[model samples]
Target: MEKNNRTIVNAWCMYDWANSVHALVIISSIFPVYFSATALGASGTPDTNFFGLQIKSSVLFSYTVSVSFLITASLVPLCTAIADFTGKKKRFMQFFCYTGAISCMLLYFFTKDTLIPSVFLFGLSLIGWSGSIVFYDSYLPEIATEDKFDAYSARGFSLGYLGSVLLLLFNLSMILAPQFYGITEKSVPARISFLTVGLWWILFAQIPFHYLPAGKKKEKRDGNWLFNGFLELKKVYGRLKEQPYLAKFLSAFFIYTMGLRTVMYVATIFGATELKLPSQSLIITVLLIQLVGIAGSYIFAWLSGQIGNIYALMIGVAIWIGICAGAYHTTEAREFDIIACTVGMVMGGIQSLSRSTYAKLIPENVTDTASYFSFYDVTEKLAIVLGTFIYGAVEQMTGSMRNSILALLVIFIIGLLLLYRIPSRKVYHLKLDHREN
Candidate 1:
């Protein structure tokens, strides 16, 4: 278990490459627009009946995303606790990887007539994509030394941006020029793009599954695993309370990430709906973001090395506040692209730094890394739930996404205040054992 082992670090990082295709193509870019267009019909804001209440298609889409994150947040801790107890984190990761990949492929069958099934599969795929990351991120403390955490984490995100951008470029070509591929309908190419994401994810995931080491198996215990898992989670919660710095960091992370995740998830839709940008412009703008994000991840990592993680994170938060304000005022396509580029610069930095910062703060003696990261992941997922719900509610009531974007400013300000209170001394001088295996 040598620190900064090349094989282990590369294998671990490759998982980001595999999964980020889904993050870009399905979650962030193409599929949301496709879903809205398909589900809402020609009117662009059709009413739908859910259980007993009627709601707008756009609002329903946001609520569906919230529900998916809510389910993942509730379930992942127990699942990770079981993985930690059994020493089977790799197996759990593999299960989600396969589940999510298959779900992405199933999206090829989605149609306007199959709204319920389409939404179900979309949520399932999101669960698979996001749920696997808890264990994948937990591997960071095991694979790299403390000093290398920020760079290693940033490298993973950089690779993800590069890899996903390549696939998206190909998919964009197919969607934009269907005649070259002998496809008659526009939706046909889009469906094929979904299949490409599925295959790419599963095929690349083999690298991590083959090379990332599985730690020693735990001793078999005499108890119901479900009950044992809950007990284990309860113990971790108590331990988290004892680490006040980590607790405060997680609170700030939860608040800011609420705004961050919502913006990332919905930005493309916002452009299409509120700004009335063409599909071609939206796709091109996303490509620009991905290209810029590769540099953004590296820049923020270097900045963290020079100025410290807290300051770099605060800089990112400040940029996000500006992006939200800009989105509210920008109506022209050129202005929107500028805002998108600004988003590109800060998105990867904030996300990558947050992960590395948390990795640095965790207790080294702790054996159950998956359980610890499960709590971290839960904070993020719960934030997504709250952020998306609030955004959707505001849009639904006011009938304008402008107000929804502005509301995120409040969340960002609160997060910035919380982040300022975190003592810098606690994070910078950690002396951790590098012999984790």
Candidate 2:
């Protein structure tokens, strides 16, 4: 209800600085390339046998990601409900952080012969990362006021982009010129990078853990947490049915995230296999994406202040449609680089704005915002499941990824139509009830 404390805000943003290294190094840049290039068998082909079917390595990677998302999507709601009911969100957050960082550290030993364990640990780390975010996002409203939601949301993402890039740049040098660091084996540098990311994730996470509010317990923890959580989700769903705008916004968010996150998840892989970009070149282009993303977060925040949240998101969706089409058409390495840059420019904007917009739109003065955001998280992860699964299945069937890229276009168009139906305003407010609440 008052102005946000500077130290507390910085601490909250710092966790983004900490955990984002995992996102960049493990999920986006280094691991994907490392798995494709160095984690292969004696035969030098990026193919793997799964259940007697031979599949390309990248396809298996996407499928693995889908499985991870499915696991996370299924588990997060009850965890958040337990956190909501018990007021121990900080504990839940810390537990997952440790799990992920430890899982990441174990990746240093991964090789061709260790494929099964590698995939299992990778999925575990994803669950850890996704699980921690359930509570991390709940802290957003606790730290900032309604007016500051968009700006503060943008600030968190900006910090994440900047921090991850700093780590990525340092790690890139080792991967490129391992001899400079006295690394003889080609895979050693990448493995060492994975080790660094794990240490970075764990050590820096303590900042927010020390300062964030332990959420207030609403009810006694005497019942079955899993079953009570389901009740909580059912209650939130009932509330949403009465609020058309929030319901509409979430529906759009769910559909569009299927396209947006799938692209983000698979972009680096596509650049390598489809665009035929080298590992060095792919990481460099990804680096550019992070650099531009810092500005993109602020740019969209300002645009939200100027044009309103819903309209700004529509424009972002339009840009995404172009990006998907462009990716489908562009073949040259340079053209793909341009697509990567465009993605960077709009990616931060859409993600930050979408988050803050939903925060602002939540039922005013509700303490159980975690349940609302849990619904949001579930919507996103499930969308990802469908998107990545479809992407992989289409590639499996048609024997080409070209149609896979085009499929995102249809998804975005649906989201754009949903967004366009909302009434235009200069800005949204917490007073959806017009002071009646």
Best by lDDT: 1
Clashing pairs in 1: none
Q: Give each model a TM-score.
A: 0.95, 0.95
Off by over 4 Å in 2: 1-3, 38-42, 427-437
Task: Write down the lDDT that model 2 would get.
Answer: 0.87
lDDT of 1 at 181: 90
Q: Model 1, range 36-118, lDDT digits (tens) per residue?
A: 67777445555665554677777877888899999998888788878887778889999989988999999998887777888
Every model's Cα RMSD, please?
Answer: 3.7, 2.8
List model 2 lDDT by residue over 315-405, tens digit each.
Answer: 9999999999999999899899999999999998999999998888887778887888888888888998899998888877877778898
| Residues forming the 10-long window of minimal summed lDDT in candidate 1 | 428-437
Residue-pair clashes, model 2: 0
